[model samples]
Target: MERTGTEPVTARSALGLRLVLAAVYTPLFVLGAVVFSLWAASAGPGSVPSGDGLAVVAGVCAALAVLAAVDLVVVVRRRRRERGGRG
Candidate 1:
């Protein structure tokens, strides 16, 4: 169960936790945004959320997308750096 000191940590393993979390949470966030929009649309004008509410949803989705992109870039660069160092 324990990791031996002889084993080297690669970027994939190092980023695995964050990547998993991001993968799970990001989709849920986007789905929630979509559902919210659909519900708002179906509810008609009186029940619809304000423009600011829609803007907030857009902003959150955008931020999550940016974060995911940055995480991917960091993982890729780390993997490349690790490979370069090993060779």
Candidate 2:
């Protein structure tokens, strides 16, 4: 059967995608935070790590989180609109 735009994507599918992205990104972010924190803790009184590596990883994970959040918001809004129409 041919699919059309009128059909909504399932909530489980949307949530699964969001959760998968979150699961993948959360660890990377936490790892980067830990490494950066440890490096900072070990540094001299007036020094920080060069931080380039940590910054890159954190940036990537932050970007992924933002995208996932946007996707989740869109999915939730769509679901709400669908339900509102049905009532």
Candidate 3:
């Protein structure tokens, strides 16, 4: 297979890796945020005291989710542009 670099690379093909990564991370981050947020909110029992550190974990998760979402949007926009305004 001789390489010539003119095989019509598509947006989906070009950005598949990053798209998959962003999609995966978005849910994971949201899940982490929800779980830690719940834990932080339910900090009114034994062992885990109130205002310990669950909130911080939740915050970080939320922040990561936001960042990942932003990345996802950027990737999607780039893909659309690559696709000649199909979005």
Candidate 4:
């Protein structure tokens, strides 16, 4: 019954891991997006160099945040279904 490395991951364990990862990353991405966005905005009013790079980074972060959020939602729904709504 020992699992080989090549064995496919079980749905439950995979989903559980995904749930944890999504939960952790969602917040981090959101925070990064916010911070970067603020920096990008501030550059416009300050003497700092062009905010173009910062703005691009912020956009990427925002996209990642949205992706993570979607992953989190999907994982939650799957876990809920796996629990048969009793949990």
CA lDDT of every candidate: 0.64, 0.58, 0.84, 0.82
**Highest lDDT: which candidate?**
3
Q: What TM-score would each prediction reach against the true structure?
A: 0.50, 0.47, 0.73, 0.75
Give the C-alpha lDDT of model 2: 0.58
lDDT winner, 1 or 2: 1
Order the candidates by TM-score, highest first: 4, 3, 1, 2
1-87, model 3: which lDDT tens digit per residue?
Answer: 244686654512547788899999999999999999898887875545554588888999999999999989989998888779965
Instruction: Give the per-residue lDDT of model 2 (tens digit) for 1-87.
Output: 345666666523355566567566656665665666566455565354445554555566566656656665666666566578531
Residue 36 lDDT in model 2? 61
- Top-TM-score candidate index: 4
lDDT of 4: 0.82
Which candidate, 2 or 3, has the higher TM-score?
Answer: 3
Q: Where does model 3 exceed 4 Å of error?
A: 1-14
Least accurate 10 contiguous residues by lDDT in model 2: 45-54
Superposed Cα deviation of residue 30, candidate 1 (Å): 2.4
Query: Sorted on lDDT, highest at the top, how do the candidates line up?
Result: 3, 4, 1, 2
TM-score of 4: 0.75
How well is each residue in 1-87 modelled by candidate 1, as lDDT tens digits?
356677656512656677676667667667766765555455555545755576567667767766776776676666667678532
